[model samples]
Target: MTSNDATRQALIVRGGWDGHQPVETTDSMIPFLERNGFAVRVEESTAIYADADYLATVDLILQVNTMSTIEKDEFAGLQAAVLNGTGMAGWHGGIADSYRNNADYLHMIGGQFAHHAGKDPAERTGEQSDNYIPYTVHISELGKTHPITQGIDDFDLVTEQYWVLSDEYNDVLATTTQSVRPWDAWNRPVTAPAIWTRQWGKGRIFVSAPGHRLEIIENPNVRTIIERGLLWAAR
Candidate 1:
């Protein structure tokens, strides 16, 4: 189909570490997009860079990869596509934690997965990990009424609660407060954003810090949040 006739095309990039279970996670997302009338193309290899022209034709980009780097030209094309109105959306460390060497990429994403505080300290290296714990997310005042979060009740999750250091300009959708433990040496409590969306040029970025495992993404509330975030972030 021609570019004008391909409004439903979506590019799903899946690679990097197996811990994120890129293949399985992205496989699970196919039906959801299909149901929503999206013609999804799952690219397990990063060779899409060889044909940068084709990547620009997609309407939405969902990255399920983690801790991998892309060539500068390939990364630039994707960034430009999003900035020019293509939707960019992902959950957890896949998208947010990707392209650590590319500052321009981080600028497009709006925030980076900094650290996680819980039982799995050493395992929680970089952006992706198996740090599961029960926590509550407090909807940000600005996002309490946003479409991505409207009518969603405050929820709890037994998953990795990300402590993301975000750009001050982000439109925070929701946040989870991290309470200080009595045994912990840190004197003050820290509050972190659990989910957020931000506008970059003519495009959009949506991120949620949950998907550590298939079970976590299987949660009804988490599913809804991810679905809504995908739609909300689409241009």
Candidate 2:
């Protein structure tokens, strides 16, 4: 790619826990990426991350792998690429919960998925949906003006609301509050970041906590946030 080039390259490395539907979710984003002038490459393994030469030419990386382990050299390659200005972006468990054993990866992302608050036991149905609840994603004052979230009003959805363990390095855009009930462990309501961005070295990392499945990803607001995030994070 040249300075005057109009097209940029995107690398999509997906595949991990099948529950997150990594393939389908990432597949849906391909056409959108192409339409935005990105030459997309989809790889199923982390092997491509170790290919420094190839990574050098990539302007953006959309990682959809969840709860997977990344090899040391492969992780190093990824870290180096970002440090040198490759943008990284992903959503839900894919970006926030991937590579549990690697603290370095977490350090780069600036947040981790702790758990999804479940409904009261009396209302639980012994299904995954037990964790799904109606919640509102509140836009922060900063978010109201940020390019990714501007003009997007706070929205409500019934889904798995994530409780993320995050640090101050992240620029929080939107948040969801987990209310305290008799059945819950926490004392008071806890507000967790639902959308955030981190500046790592020369790269920008964008994360959205709402996309647990295709339906959630396709939500008009969620889709717009992600689309804008991809372009915002690109090198």
Candidate 3:
């Protein structure tokens, strides 16, 4: 587990749907990664996904691209790199909504963005509305002692608590209850993962679905989680 700063390499791939402010969010995280001793690389295209030579040298990847197309080989190369022991860490759509059509990518990442209550058809399309309800994120019992969620108490935020499509493989660390309301009604309330971790081959995968905006990255608890998650996922 002893890693030298000089040898640890990280790649930041940024560029996709601008609404998510992919580059800005990625920029918000770079200084933190650099301070943690990783030699970080920033790229604007998924084309970097196909560079096997470069992928082979990376220890961790910070993907900030959202809703983008990834070519077959490019996707395969990323999967292979992680399977070979590289780590993958990211937040929100950048990680969960990256490739809509790639199932392998979804399986490896362990979840996908199904919808946020605010984005439901019934709710009017406006960023600031009742649709954006204030909710609290509770750390699961399993997360109480986990390094990522340690010392973090239940916190409330006025943002989209993403309802995700997940699996049994994830070690869910935090979750929130989805309340059924007229504007965004569900048959019943369902608890969904707010943060989680999983593995693929030798790779470590970490995801936090809270930082949809750059401000969310500034949340002390959220920032701490991502910082710790990045280190934990690193090879």
Candidate 4:
């Protein structure tokens, strides 16, 4: 199709840590994108990021990769694509915790996953569930007016609540606080961005720090925000 085609193109690059259920999570959104007029493309690797010619044709990129590495050239191509107006969106560790060693990627994302503070030591079972905790996502006043989160009331969730290191460049839409517990090292409670967006060059980037699993992605509020975010960020 030509660049002027009415059908927008979305590229989904998913696959990394199975703990995040990347495949299932990204697959769940395929129908949503299709129904909204996106011609979707799914790939299991970041190798496609190196294909500048193809990336140029993409209107949006939905990445669900976690803790994986991207080669220098691959990242360069992806960076160039976004700089030229291709939107990028993703959630949780897939976008926040990816490419631990790549500072340039983190800079582009405007945030990085510091860690997920686990539950009370008493509840620890040496399993992934140990990181699950009850928390609230507080929407910012600006978020109330933003298209992606408007009308969405604050909500609670029992899951991996992320503690993120973000920059001033991000427009934080929602945040979650990590409280000070007797077993915790931090002296006081700290709030971190749970949902945010950034404008880079001619492109837009959106991130919601929720979707760790399919069920979480399917949450009505989370789903709505993500769907709107995808559309909002699309070129």
Candidate 5:
């Protein structure tokens, strides 16, 4: 692609649960791309199928969708585009909790938010028992050496601590351990994968489970990790 081609391109898709704050989350990233010379385009719907070739011209794909079902053809177009070298990156439920019925989507993303086994339960009872319960995220062994995590340290946040079921194929960047409560638990302590990167064909995929809201993304460390991850994933 020529400079003109690159200058004319950017693709951003945002939809799904309102709680995840897709609109606010993706809007926050628009200026970043614009500053980097991308002509950012934001889509409020997931109708990426209407222009299947749009991904072909895009320099990067920023998805802020969560827990939404995608049609086969639409997802196939995205899968092919990413595999063919269109960059893919997203954080939290937007990426990890997206397209639950599509195994291919999950495969490309490398993991899914399985359960939160620490303080919050699957079923909330009290006012303070929501999934948005706060906790600190520890930067584990692998984070020290990864480009996306370079200079980043252990950070604290008041967001959902993702308990992800990740494929061993991923290059895990960070992790947080959650201790199981014996009274309500089924197993021993399990370590959760917090951030990861993986390759799909000639393209790249990045997942970060921190941005539950715009405020969560505002954290300097979280923002830095996401900013680096987006660039790293893009071609």
Candidate 6:
């Protein structure tokens, strides 16, 4: 497909932990955005967040960034743009774990990655506890009707069960449960959100917790949800 620079604009700012393969993950989504009529640009730095005037011109932001610190003004500009109607979407730690110290950013995104209950994959030199665990996601009744999740059934992922500090504001679409194990500090299976959408002013926010690796992101249902979610979020 040809780039339609006049249709819409998107910015993908990616970096932080290499374990998440931010570059590769962000690269994989460029074609989707382009195919959907967005002229996408990739950036390696969060400094782009400081450019409010330029940000105002963007229609969407797909961030595959991780625990990178954001300058106060840069963070502020990002919040302003989203609140002013620029759509935001991301998966896993890229969106949920960004900026450990930025509360406003978390509020806009609607959640924060607390910690993964499982050990990290041995191949990666990052945080390790429980790296891979099989879990099933149950689609909510609302999800069956929501455009982002329409026709997608409940699926399973053998990745980390993200235990996020999320609020009730999100329009949850799917959920997963963590059965209490000997390693768990708490007993009883706990259900947590796997996919959700939220609003920040006039902008749309979509998040999915399953994309820990390229394979998971490439899953048919995962790809469809992410693609449709981004398109839906865009102005």
Q: Highest TM-score among the candidates is held by which one?
A: 4
Candidate 5, residue 104: how far the Cα is off, in Å: 0.9
lDDT per residue for candidate 6 within 131-178, as digits (tens), equals 677888889999999999988899887778888778899999998887
Model 4 lDDT per residue over 12-94, tens place: 99999999999999988888888788888999999999999999999999999999999998899999999999999999999
lDDT of 1 by residue, 1-235 (tens): 1133344888888888788777777777777877776788888865674466786677778887788888887877887788788888888888878878888888888888887666645555555434566789787777678988888888888777888877787888888877676645567888777888878888888888888767777888778888888877766
Name the 10 consecutive residues with the lowest summed lDDT in model 4: 1-10
Clashes within 3 Å, all models in order: 0, 0, 0, 0, 0, 7
lDDT, model 5: 0.81
lDDT of each model, Cα atoms only?
0.78, 0.93, 0.87, 0.93, 0.81, 0.86
Instruction: Tell me which of candidates 4 and 5 scores higher on TM-score.
Output: 4
lDDT of 3 by residue, 85-141 (tens): 999999988999999989999999998988877645555665544346678899999
Name every residue pair that clashes in candidate 3.
Answer: none
Stretches off by above 4 angstroms in model 5 are: 1-8, 118-129
Candidate 5 lDDT over 1-235, as tens digits, reads 1233336466788899998889889889877877667777788766774466677887688888998999888888888888788888899989999889899888888989987543535456654236555566777677787889977888877767888988789988888776666544557767778888999998898888888889889989999999989888877
Against the true structure, what is each candidate's TM-score?
A: 0.88, 0.96, 0.93, 0.97, 0.89, 0.93
RMSD of 5: 3.2
TM-score of 6: 0.93
How far in Å is the alpha carbon of 68 misplaced in model 6? 1.1
Error of 6 at 88 (Å): 0.5
lDDT of 2 by residue, 1-235 (tens): 1123338999999999998899999999988888888888899999999999999999999999999999999999999999999999999999999999899999999989998988889989898799889999999999999999999999998999999999988999999999988888899999999999999999999999999989999999999999999999999
